[model samples]
Target: MKVCYLISAVSSDNTGRGGHYESLKILAESIYENGLDVEIVSLGDIFPPTFGNTSVKVRFIQFKKSDSLIQYIKKVADEIYDISPNVIHSFDNKSYFFARLANVKIKCKLVLTKPGGPNPKLFFPRCNDLIVFSQENFAFFKSRSRYKDVNVHYLPNRAKKILCDDLRIREIKELYDISGKVILRIARICDSYKESFIQLINLVNGLNDQGFSCTAVIIGFIQDQHVYDEIIALDCKYLRVVTEERYTKNASALIDLCDYFLGTGRGVFEAALLNKLVFTTISSSRYPVIIDEDNIDELQHNNFSPRSILKNRTEASSKEFLSSVIQILSDEIKLNEKRKYILSVAKQRFDISSVMDSYMEIYLNCFPFKRNLIFDIILNSLVVLKVYALLKLSKNKKAKA
Candidate 1:
């Protein structure tokens, strides 16, 4: 089936961590791999690298970000009329809101993928189906009865494959000047959350007080000018901030040396895939999270209370950061076991193949008009198995030869 995928922006040159361009890339590639007709329409200067390389068509309808809903819809409608797709999948709430507002009787099946946000319980104009990163959030949304007839579905946020080539692990070790046992935090320097930064600073102070000799490497961009200032003030040797090119290479490299990732982060699953420990709290329902935490440090409210910008996180105050840090430090085997569990779970549920199946099922459900017979399903399944076997054998033969 031919599908039209629309997103906010896919700028490879300036892909902020918050932007879901990588996820969009994976989805687009999978659609083409499955032998489906696909066209991508997005705002901004971003173009898919393989746009002309693939059979799938990629089109750009350049529109300003500030365009109002009516104006935006008119712009999209003009193009939609020209290249009618079987379905239109909107990437996030902003794009979904605009698309739904634009298309009332929605000629094509409308689908949306929600990848969590600073604002939880986002109120968006209804679509055919709501694809969430968490089943828990989906159930919560379903219970609220926002849209009576709309379908809500859950799919795990798939891990990204960094375009990193093999390098001597030791080269990375010396480049970061890392000690192999360092702690890593790969969050963007600038973020939309005040609590996220506040909590991180508290955690660092907590870890230091306990005399944990672990280093912290700050990967990703510094979005906030003030936060950048705060980080500079620390002047901590172990915790250094690097930007752009260094940031990209260091991430793939740091994955090897880091024993654990400890932050409220966007890179937990990425860490898990690279075989590192990821530790963070289960964010309050107020915040959106896609990747389920293997261990959640329940928030201790009183401990977070402060009269001013500097908060007091003492044991007497409810034991928020200190207790969880201590608990994590005390249990080495626990973190190791959690790492093992993450790898096992990822291999089963969040791999590219399984994630592609989730998208296909959603596609089939959203557009029942396109019917494939039972025989078609059987034939496709057999072909998939044959392809898998041939690839496996090719690898085996190459190793032997």
Candidate 2:
């Protein structure tokens, strides 16, 4: 059966920055290698780097600035109709929305994979199958009455073991002036993570001030320039911020140069595959929790994200946070044991071959089913209205403040 993977964009560049983009590339490549006819339909411009090296064909749906939402979706629908794919699988909310509206005309099997934590503002369109990367997300959707009839599957993110040339590693270290005990983070520089970034910079500087040799290197795309500027303005000597333009290659290689990783999602799992100790924190968290054998299962349930612990989150003093980290860092035997256990878990949980098999099973079973177009559209419209109301309320509160 032909599969059309739909996405908002192919990549920011050849070396993709975000988790969903990377995961799409990996999954698409695997599907192509299995000899199934696989094609990618992108709503945004496809960068040359991402498609140049791949065998799978990519179609870009150009959007005119003057076009209304209906017109844009019609363009997407027309493209899918021409392709006549057996299944149209979309990633991200925007693409999923367009896929749902477009499929009303085409009536093909639709599949959506939630790339991140559930967003209250976004609606999950009724589809043949819905896949979530974390167990927490699975439970969240399953408990919702709206999703009771939908098939929800919990599939952990997958990562291939990364290997880098020694020369490249040495060159990167020298270029960044990285030395001492390195703390690395790979995530988007956005408002949601602004506080966490500040706390991390201060934590690293505190370690250095206390005579501990340490430095932190944060690498990611600049989604929020204001947040990125704030982080840069801090000017901490112990911290280095690498934007997307500078660090374009597979970031997992950088994990090899670090003693610890402070981030979440696929990066955490990738670091674990590399046997690097991983630590994560919730939004506004004063302390970061190390993902060790004791809490690996819990963290994995939330996709190794800060959201996993958000509900029970309590702020600790900076001193307390530093003390806990220092204790863990000082214990070499325990750190080594933790690394070994996390590596074993990563191998068992995130093997790409096994993940591909699961995906294939889902795709094969996703047969065309009857859907109530009018009811689904009305329900989705209500969800959108609710999100708008919430946003307006938030804006009013901010204005009052």
Candidate 3:
């Protein structure tokens, strides 16, 4: 069986935090082990030099963001035409949207997962199955994930266990000499939306003043060196920003090393998977402050989204948000109370052992025939399309009359 992953860029060069890479890493390893052919195709979004170091087999298709919707759709279809896989699993909105629009003529299965914030507008008319991370997210669009119409799987997003041997982790621990009650924000500096970085800074600073004495480690690709330099230039010595590369190895290690894990974008999912204590901030534009790329990325998902317009994420009461942050970090019992549920939920919903079984079941259902009966069905289906076309002509005439 040939299965392909359509995701954001998978450049062997990048060694940073990316949902596409992490999930696919686990999948490819499992699928390849099962003796199935696997390939991952990049959708040409994101900064260059993605982690190509993984064992997951990969390829890239140069898709431009500037292209018109029609052009983009055609290009997506064209790319799939060339890949010719029996099953395609697409990640995030753009890949998922365009893959459905491409809708190439093939007896293949299509499965999609929401990579970040759930944007309901991106849903296509038809796909074999859907996977969503949050039940709250699925509830917002219950019609789309009804389990009967589509094999909607409430498979919570999961990362393969971080290798623990990453070089950057070693580097961060040695370089920072990090110790005692550390809070972490490890996400892409260029995610589709943006914000919460500076509030996160202020929030952390506020907690420190409350006698919590916690340090925050910020990690992601600083696309601009001057901006990065300016962030480090801040008077708040507790807030530290590191390169995208170090964020994964070093920062994720720091998350493993730290007392509390702060959620920004999908990074919360990572921390949750690792059994770290995590908190996702309520969006509060109510307490206005300077929001930058990293913050905005977390808030807006940084501009890679098909629909980045998000007021719900940014418009939260910062003071209340700050209070919650302090309470969770300062109160051990309260923190663990939340952690017990999250860890329990993660193991139950995102566990990897049964994923391969799920995929195989979906494939068989979407394209049911493995023999020449499929050919007979196709011949009959073609005749049905022809008969439908003729019936459409008759219906149009009757309407005109």
Candidate 4:
């Protein structure tokens, strides 16, 4: 079985580092381990130019973003024709559209992993399979009249378990000079999650003022210059901001250095796996509290969607939420066993290895077959030229206008 991924560049201020690229790399490797072939067609210009480093041997095609939409679609289709992959999986809508066009004659299984939003536009009828991270998203898809027969899978995201020795964890702590209660919140310096970096600083400041010796470790890549500047301006002594390049690369190590997690989405799961008390500010029934057995299912089914959870509860302020966080952290001694229970659930559910079988089954059932290579090459070349001409004509029209 051969699968080709049509993904865009990881350069957007929002949703770029939301594990779209990282998860693809992990999934591709897992697929390869099951004795299938995998390839990638990365769209746009990925800055820092240092993504997708993996051991899985697959052909990597860099699709330049400078081209017009017609040109871009043509290039994708041409690559699909040349590769003749049995399955074309896309991570976003634009790529899915182009992949559908590319597979017009090819008739391959098209899969779409929905983008970061509640109401993602599901337009391609050719998409045989759809993957969503939450029940809410699944419900949204089901409500769409166009996809009554489409197969939509509500598969929650998974993460590799973080492994570190006690010595290593201690070293990380010492590097940051973290001696007191360590609180970690991992997110990009963006406004997508209704998260305020300024608010976090205030929370840390509040904790210190209340005679609690604690350090707030804010670790994430800086996507917005304005937000980054605002965070830096505060310079709260208790807040240690680690705005390093590719901070997600070192997320596990950083998670190990914290006593509590004060974030949403994947970071909360990672902290739970590491046996730390986790409190999410995201939308869910258990918002602003430690994730326990009683509320794990709701959060899990909801995919820990931060922004959505916060939207309904407009009355919930960060200052009010911080008080609950303070109360939880202050009573850490009494909640030690609850912390262990949270880790147990996280390990059982969120580990990538545990969930690989479902993915493997999906790939295996895609019904792989070969297409006429000679005819595809001939047709694709003609289509490419046609698109190029249309692109030129469009440009001319725009210039004349």
Best by lDDT: 2
List TM-score per model, in order. Answer: 0.66, 0.83, 0.64, 0.77
Better of 1 and 4 by TM-score: 4
- lDDT tens per residue, model 1, 1-401: 87877765423223324425455656777777888888777643344332333345667765443454346557767776666667778775545543443454446677887664322443344555877665445656677664555688767556554444346335545666766356655555663443444444455555666666666656656657688787768666556455555444335434555676643422555666766665543332211111234223121111111111112222233244455555655588866666777666556655566777778878877842212233433443343334334444555576789
Report the error of model 1 at residue 160, Å: 4.7
Model 3 lowest lDDT segment of ten = 285-294
Model 3 backbone overlap count: 31
Q: What is the lDDT of candidate 3?
A: 0.56
CA RMSD of all predictions? 14.3, 5.8, 12.0, 6.4
- The weakest ten consecutive residues by lDDT in model 1 span 299-308
- Which ranges in model 1 have alpha carbons more than 4 Å from their true place? 10-19, 44-60, 64-75, 78-83, 97-106, 118-122, 160-176, 191-212, 245-254, 263-266, 281-335, 367-401
lDDT, residue 392, model 4: 53
Please give the CA lDDT of all the candidate structures: 0.54, 0.72, 0.56, 0.64
Decoy 4 TM-score against native: 0.77
Candidate 4 C-alpha lDDT tens digits along 118-177: 564423332457887777788887888666656787777776666644674565566668
